[model samples]
Target: MKFSCVAAVALASAACGSGDGAHADPDLGVESSDTGALLAHADPEASGSCQLPDGPRTVHQMKGPLEDLQGDCVPTWTQEELNAGFTRIRDERMITLPENPGFERRIPWLAADNGCEERAQAASYYLTNWDYTTPYYARVLVKPNKRLILKTDNEPGGSVRWTHHVAPVVRVDGRLMILDPAVEPEKPLPIEEWLPRFSVAGEVDVALCRDHAIGDGCFAAAPVAPSPPQIGDKAAGLHLRLTAEWGVQEILGRDPHRVLGDCPPWVECEAEPTPDENRPPTIRHFRTDRLESEVFFPIYVIGDNFVEGVTTVRVTGNGVDEIALIDSSTMRSILLASWYDPGEYQVTAANGAHVSQPVVMKISEF
Candidate 1:
């Protein structure tokens, strides 16, 4: 589905920041080519076209001759578009994973006991038949009866691993189909022969398969845990909550690098300001400072009398480099920072620069 252009721009702005006065790293992981390495494996001779009944669609028919399936397919959205889309998907689905005891963590096919080959074949068939565009993440919905169906990238011989990679599938007529980018990378196998080698631990029935959704958009929503008051100290608490959301995205293999080609590797953090409320309340001693190290330059906050009851501090840009709480009177950094206690603390950059805003946490005593 299409997202609001304004919202997309806001999200992108939050992720990349203004880059004004921001130090750019020359040797960062950003690649010259915009296309992902994974997509480079598409077979030149595969005998299928992306022309589905809908508009200009790309379809990979599993069990087809490679030569017959060769065609050029371009992604509709740019890297920025995909990044914003991924962030939205993560925020929406962050709370779906099961948190209680005895919960299954791994994807159904990725389990140890299941046959890897059979699962691979089924994944291949599903991918060959579907259309996949970049800037999209796949959400695998496994049902109870062993039926495995997906909503993204229908190409013949394509396989889905727990890593969240889906390959191309080419079907030659009805007899033989091949999946590209196999684990071996050298050999493409027939679907029927490959299916038995993979195991089917769980099944998924598609409750919803909306087109162009960021992730699978198939599985039913899972329960979410309530946000905790304080997880740890200022830094730890923020990191914990962000990490939980990142972990869920990782489980689905929705890394920014994979979904959005050429995007920087970023650790997700909470965005504090809203469209209506753009800036935090100003205090007298509040200051904005930049911390620089051999690796990165990060923004931080510093202030006195900042702690208040259940105050929500919003942070944007890249992930935190390091955080330290300090005593205001002593002017010395405190080793222990606790969210439960009210105290004056200083937040400094790992590279030895004072943060602009010193976040204050105040909990009500009722």
Candidate 2:
């Protein structure tokens, strides 16, 4: 169950300290120490290649109440903010490096223990380095202990520390993406998937970008030219701490009410993402919760006489034109549930003797 491509080794250590001697103390927090092991996926041995553990394949060990059952008021953006963010990125005003073609998750200076500290540190670094070119950036509030997929501690109503987090979100590739240079460092994940990891009660994103040319002012979150954290200082004492109240949001000096308490009426609340469509290949109609197979979710390519027609096959529109031709068909298609982000593609099948319609296979992001 190595979700996504289990390729590169994850860095298990980070450097976290403020120039003001905030991390000089050994008792800073639980998530600051390497041996404390906040994220089990982070390698305990600093010298070891940072690979995920081979147990039950889940993203993170920590879990909180799902959004529906939650009883907290999370602060989120108004429609105006979303619109501005979209506009800023589309204008190509955010920072970028040729190395970053997007889809990355490596924070070079963060360890497993430096959750909130990494947020603080990375925000400080980006604010300093990209000050000139940054059209818009924000000290975004995030839901603590948010996992990309659901696999958990398996305890009900236990002492789950539902903490709030502070991270940087920058407009990238004409969309706002989370630049969480700590936990999932450098991974410019889509805002839609990243936002769900923030406080469910609510989130008030603090604007951090300033157009220096126009002399626009920006909120002062960290030093104007702070140095980035390195290995030793970054992973020392930045462990996560449990709290009954808003944690990182308060630590980052944001208004706690923006994350918890009364909900301000707004129309920007987005609907949940639609799951991948499970269209029965045999017919035009597709249905959800269908009892297709015993394997739970089976990716089907239903069609009449799929074995007869076989030709120049390859998966198209997948960034790369992967020429994987399906020579012989045992059944209709191979199970595709295990493939990550296997959506938005066409299977170019060739007709042998008879002319038939090309079987187009679309895998949605369920």
Say which candidate scores most in TM-score.
2
lDDT (Cα, tens digit) per residue for candidate 1, span 47-110 = 3553222321211111122223222221233344333332332222111222322321111121
lDDT, candidate 2, residue 70?
Answer: 14
Each candidate: RMSD? 20.6, 20.5
Please give, for residues 1-366, the per-residue lDDT of candidate 2 as tens digits.
Answer: 000101110113222211112112211111222232222222122223323224331112212223321111111233454344333322222322233324222222222222343434434344334321222223332343432221111111111222233344433333445545333332445555654543333432222331100011222111122333332222131222112122322222222233222221111333422212222122111111222211223333333233323322345675746645332332233222334244555544333433234444554545
Best by lDDT: 2
Total clashes for model 2: 33
